[model samples]
Target chain A: MGVSIFGLAWRSLMNRKVSAFLTIFAIALSVALFLGVEKARNAAKDGFDNTISGTELIVGAPSGQINLLLYSVFRLGNATAEISWPTYEAIAARNDVAWAVPISLGDNHRGYRVLGTTQSYFEHYKYGQRQSLAFAEGEMFDDLFDAVIGSEVAKQLGYEVETPLIITHGLGAGGLTDHDNRPFRVVGVLRPTGTPVDQTIHVSLEAITAIHVGWETGARNPLADNIPEETIRGFNLTPRTVTAVFIGLKNRATVLRTRRDLNTNMTEPLLAIIPGQALAELWQVMSTAERVLLAVSAFVIAVGLVSILTSILTSLNERRREMSILRATGARPSHIMTLLIAEAAVLGFMGAVLGAILIQIIFAVAAPILSAQYGVALMGTGPGLVDAYTIGAVTLAALFLGIWPAITALRRSLADGLTVKV
Target chain B: MTQPIVSLSDLSFAWPGQPPVLDVKAFELNRGERLFLRGPSGSGKSTLLGLIAGVLEANSGAVHVLDQDLTELSGGQRDRVRADHLGVIFQMFNLVPYLSVVQNVVLPCRFSKRRLGEVQAAGGAEAEAKRLLARLGLSDEGLLSRNVTELSVGQQQRVAAARALIGNPALIIADEPTSALDADSRDRFIQLLSDEAQKTDAALLFVSHDGALAPLFDRAIDLAEINHAASIMEQA
Candidate 1:
């Protein structure tokens, strides 16, 4: 049988192994970067969307929609204001509300946000297709100082069921007084949800009020030292103010009416947002950055292809004699073009596959860190259809990119057939 | 008696935006004839070979090889004729360096169905390639597998010759095929190439500036004597 032209192309590439490898590596790295960025973007959007999947409305003190979603669901930037206890009560009493999980923030446990809420949070708070939180180890918080820690918080802090979790008076990395005397015990650790909830320490509303009852304003009272945990039940621990209330409507159709009522409250101005719409709005805000990332990666791929073109064109000068040989052996100008195109296609395909393997290796190393720090879970290291599409598009682009050098080779062969310059 | 293997009539050619380089009123090479074409550098030696190979088309008139009027054929049809009926060898030993000696020898058969069919009739492409190489005294088993880059200049020359003579093409065009060889190897190479051409019953046109090689061929034609453009160039 005749030697396949593709086989010839392969042999030609193998002839210049060093340049072929360099070109393949450049293309692979660029493809890896493009694929990595795209995966990270999708993972981030998935994490955000999974944060508060079933919440119908988020009612908070009148604030920006993005801010309310951020502080309430994402545990991102803090809410500028708080919804009053009376306003929260009135909203919770409405017939349209099925269950409301009021969130009282402004506390942290070793940098993980400490969310103060009722048992309703553990019971009704849903995420990722209305999947309720399941404990990885133990049961929900029952005692006054009992804490339900998210999966990441437990993993990072190495907290077990009985580990003493000290709550801080505020949210930042510095200058916050710790409630060391009234430490909470880790009661439960939630399973990985790939959401903000995985990064929070959940405590009851009474604990939020109990920890700061004696602190006058932001200052610690010297006389109110060492309040015993046993006596905490003796004190009234009703939360007077919460940051936001996540409401789930009894009927999905009543969401608009309830939102309008909350927004038009005469007693106190409140902001209500459907969590899904807010998340979509957040995606809108982030889509620009996503597009920029894709654009930059695409530009890098273009640069990689240009480098391939340059390498091939440079080799074309050296291969002028080779082209003449092919011409002498009965190859037409079109055959020369096909040979170059085939070589480039092989390079592109090899690079894409190498890049995919590289990406999987990178994700394997970075997955744990990403989940721990950003709550963005990279579920698996396998390639998806999008990855296949990317490789296909890149290979096709490479075939097209080969035209310049192929044309150059064709012209050279036609001009210098079987002629030795010497 | 048989139609000439190659016939050019009133052929004229020139580089674009340049004066005519070749104006041959008539040129013919009979079947199985070996013709030595002598010309100086820049005297249209390579240009005439290009026209004969169908790589270049004359400005006026026709090049008929194996009874096909190359001027009447489309560029692609001319390529087909070149592939099926003609073999070319260049002076620089243009063996695709990455390919094995066997691979380089069989390359013509890769592009031409007719050549491939001929090789198949001789058992297989590789076998025919090996047969031709052995006829040119390149039968070392190790050398056949080695890349052409590893071969000596003379060995490489034999490989090029084997490639050109593989499929029993009607005509063989050799452009300074021995220019890069030493005198001993040059004579040996020409003997092997001419012997292979005779075995295949193919007409041979060997172009070179060296006049010493002319006596070995069936006939010698000084290109300056026939290319009218050469006389005009000499006058200017």
Candidate 2:
């Protein structure tokens, strides 16, 4: 009996192939968009939360928490104020400090920023928890003049090992050129991290100071130019000030105490923010954008559902004779309703599954560009909890939207049974 | 004849805001009897058929079919009776165009367990449906799986006859079933309908305005002459 009803539904759908195909296409497209939005939303959250993974605290000169997070983890903006080298040394010397990587900013190669830090920056500074830097090609920086470039910098600039690149003195393309006379040789390149690190150029702290040593009285020194590079290296080249410091605690329990001490007794005004808390604060500040995106996607889905309803309702008039025939065949009003409801549910389910598969395909194709350009990695792994929830929600919405027309069909069929005319 | 299978007592019906359409003192249909009900358009011929099939309730009086008062039965029970004991074939659009020929004939069984049981009891439902289709002169090669829309009007009418005759219903109501056919096809349709009705031993109430088909039935009644109140209401 169930088989016959299903056969009837199949035949009815086939009889109106054009309309059925159009309806299925609308459903498929809507499901794709709905699932795509869901995937991007969760991916954004994952990328944001994991931006500074494995780090306990970020210490910088007093500034907005968001700024500190953006610069220290994402490498987006520059630090407004710098912590003196003594402050970094003080923080690094503490008993509870397991590792500290002091970072110096304020330089750029073309548009990409150049970061100056120690070897520990590559070894101990992690993004995703315990995720060490993996070098796709050559080794990490070994000498003062040799540099390690990010994956994006290598791909965009077409730089290979031994390629000489000069640095400018500020954040952007228009920044003042500083290291014009002494270009650094690219030594190694880090693999894609899907973070801002992918777009940065990393050098040693000594190299950062060495590039500035030629300046006397805030002007270029003629004597410094004539001196051979070997002779000039004899001068003290240690950095006096650095942008920020990343601290990893030997024990997790002492992070709070250490943060409090830095806030209280630090000679310079400084702020220590837990990376996770700072990330959450950043997410809160950006919640409006997320909400706007979600609301727009939802509205689009609503429009799609409305189209489905309108199409089905409009076709009801043309199908009057068909409905009457079903009635004459002894199909109850509820049976007619069930056929419609089942069609809608089936369409919604198929659309969702197809949409999710499309999203994963899109992610796979775009992963490389996303890692380089936006520093956001979209993996092609199976759906997570959030993806599942979105598909389920969209399906339910489609079914709910379908009910009105199913009821309409039922009512029309019942009225048709009474009229006895086609 | 045995006790009448259908009896209409003082039946009167009218369209809303219109004059009376049907008012008959009595109408009886005996078991296995073939009756021709002749009436012109707007003479309440189809309305009476509607009442007898319980598709529409009579505004006054009672319609009894198979010894049960149609008016006394609930709407669901009326539907059940129609599904179980009565088969109706309309003039046109009788079959669901999307369904195959055999599927259309098996529709009544889908609705009523009693009809299904009867079909199954007679050497399985499919076998019975095929046998009936064969008797109706439908080709076995195309009859079982052919969509009803693909058949000519004459062929479709024959398929409809077979559908109405399936499950051996106690009564069959055909409303101008051959009106759309040519004269020759109409003759063939009438002969086929009568032969199939005799085989099932079901009372057949065949309604049509064409008097040429009247001789095929055992009895004939002119609805307009028999309905006195219908004419009086029309005059008033």
Fnat, one value per model: 0.67, 0.30
Task: Give the alpha carbon lDDT tens digit for every residue of A1-422 in model 1.
Answer: 64688998999999899999999999899999999988878877877777777789989988889998888888888888897888888888888899888999988977899999989888888988899999899998888889999989988989989998788878755344877767799989999888888899999889888888678578677556666666767988888889999898999998898899889954899999998898899899999999999999989988887778888889988888888878878898888999999998888888888888899899989898877877677753468987899889889998998998999889877777557453
lDDT of 2 by residue, B1-236 (tens): 46899999998887667677788889999999999999887677877877887767778898999989998987677778888888888888777877778778888888888889888899877778788888888866755677777788888888888888888999988889898999988898889889999988998999998888889999999887678665644653
TM-score of chain A of 2: 0.87
Q: By DockQ thresholds, what CAPRI class is model 1?
A: medium
Tens digit per residue, CA lDDT, model 1, B140-162: 89878787777888888888888
> Which portions of model 1 show Cα errors greater than 4 Å?
A172-176, A378-382, A420-422, B230-236
What is the C-alpha DockQ of each candidate?
Answer: 0.62, 0.39
In order, the Cα lDDT scores of the candidates are 0.86, 0.80
Residue pairs whose backbone atoms clash in candidate 1: none
